[model samples]
Target: MATLLLRFLLKAALAFLAVSVLWVGVYRFVPPPVTFTMLGDVIGGHGITKDWMSLSEMDPDMARAAIAGEDSRFCAHHGFDFRAIGNAALRNAKGGRIRGGSTISQQTAKNAFLFQGGGYVRKAFEAYFTVLIEALWPKRRIMEVYLNIAETGIGTYGANAGSIRYFHHDASRLSASEAGRIAAVLPLPKKRAAISPTGFVRRHGNTLSRRVATVRDQGLDACLR
Candidate 1:
């Protein structure tokens, strides 16, 4: 009975490997149709709203804002940022709110291929997918996919959708402040609105907006460029 169970588990593992490879390969060329997170929102009566925008189509400041706010070392790291992970771990150990060190590539992997939330099992799978994506897709492609698929607002997905919902404009020509505001809502989209942020959200958005110029000047988004 143990041998039979082992065989079944082995088969399942191999099947998952094959399917995941295929999924990543396909998405390297095609925008992902949907994600589990989007599906869950739809199931919960919050219909998914998304507008696919390529990296070239959106304002460059938007990408810069993401790099400045979420992952300053996005271009420097492969799939993980060990330094950021260490910093977050140390901070969490100090007994405040838990923090994550997920790089944009890792977040892109999760946003594109997996569900939100956490667990060791989910994290292991996320890591595997992150490696696959870094190996299969270019850095620019990864950024493009992340910006297009990331949850930007409640029941809304992607920068374009969020821009339209909040500012009544498309993402093609976002001002630095506008882009930063949208990026700021990324960490907790459901609870925050970019339209009229206050407190930490407003302050963080302002900080990100200022950092956009630094990102551009220092070529922090060099990979995307």
Candidate 2:
């Protein structure tokens, strides 16, 4: 009986590995059709809103703004940023609310492959998928997938959709300020609005706008280039 159970578990694990590898490999060239988060939004009646735009079609400032705001060392790190993780751990230790140290690559992995917000089990899967994408996809493809799939507003997904929803334009030609505003809403898209931001959101958007130029100047997104 114990041997049978062990065999079953081993088969299950192997099946998972094979399927996940195939999924990641296919997404290397094909844009993902849907994700768990998008489905949840649809179920909640928020409806799906996404406009897929290739990285090449987007204005350079948009990607630069993301690099400046979300992960300054996006080009430097592999799948994880240990320094940021260490900093987040220190902050969480003080214990107001938990924070994550996820890099854009890790976020991409989660957004692409897994459902949102779970405990250690989900995190282990997230890490595994992150490694898989980093191995199978190029840096540019990873950025493209993240930009296209990220939740930008309540039910809205991708920079182009967010741009149209907020700025009445697509992401094809976003200015620094516009890109910054969209990027600012990324951390808490449901709570924030790029149309009329105030307080920290406004300030952070402005900061990100300025940093966009710096990111370009410093070549922080060199990997995408």
Candidate 3:
């Protein structure tokens, strides 16, 4: 029985490995359209289309704002941010409802590897994939994938689609404030519109804008270096 159990586990591990390799290959080579369960609503309601933006063409402002809003220590961390994770744990312990310690790496892992919303098991898988991605992919590649797959607006509007839909411009053309507004809506993309101004979005945008300026002034490249 023990031998049979071990064999089963080994097979499971091999299957997982094969799936991971296939996922990475598809992501790197195929410009396949990623469809999400939640994104369909956003696109249908907003009347937007799909698009992609390369890292070379992406606006520096959008990158900075994303760093500020999602992972302030992204340039310094490998796959996880201990400080943010600890803080999230403490907040959860204190009965805070908004307890997500996921880093940009973790989010990328979840998006790349699994479906949305399945509780702790999904989160565990996300962490596992996060470690794998950090080991196999560069920081730039990770960021690029995050920006490409991240749900930026309510319906099917990803970063590139959201950039064009809301701003009426390409991701490469986003200004600092415009980028901040988009980044601010990330936490609640399903509830917020990137184009329409809400009080919460405006306040968050301001906060992100300040962080972007600080990242710029302090030099984000220095952190990565």
TM-scores, one per candidate: 0.96, 0.97, 0.87
- Where's the lowest-lDDT run of ten residues in candidate 3? 29-38
Model 1 CA deviation exceeding 4 Å by range: none
Winner of 2 and 3 under lDDT: 2
Worst 10 residues of 2 by lDDT: 96-105
CA lDDT for candidate 1 = 0.93
Off by over 4 Å in 2: 95-98
Q: TM-score of the candidate numbered 3?
A: 0.87
lDDT tens string, model 2, 1-225?
999999999999999999999999999999999999999998888888999999999998888988888889999988899999999999999998687788899999999999998989999999999999999999999999999999999999999999999989899979999999999998898999998999878999999999998998898989988
Q: TM-score of model 2 relative to the true fold?
A: 0.97
TM-score of 1: 0.96
lDDT of candidate 3 over 1-225, digit per residue (tens)? 999999999999999888886776677645436645345445556543557776667887777888888888887888999999999988988894676777888988877667788998988888888888887777777777777777776553457788887988888888888889888887777777778677889888988887888888877634432
For model 1 the local lDDT of residue 138 reads 95
Give per-residue lDDT, candidate 2, residue 136: 96
- Which pairs clash in model 1? none
- Candidate 3 structure lDDT: 0.77
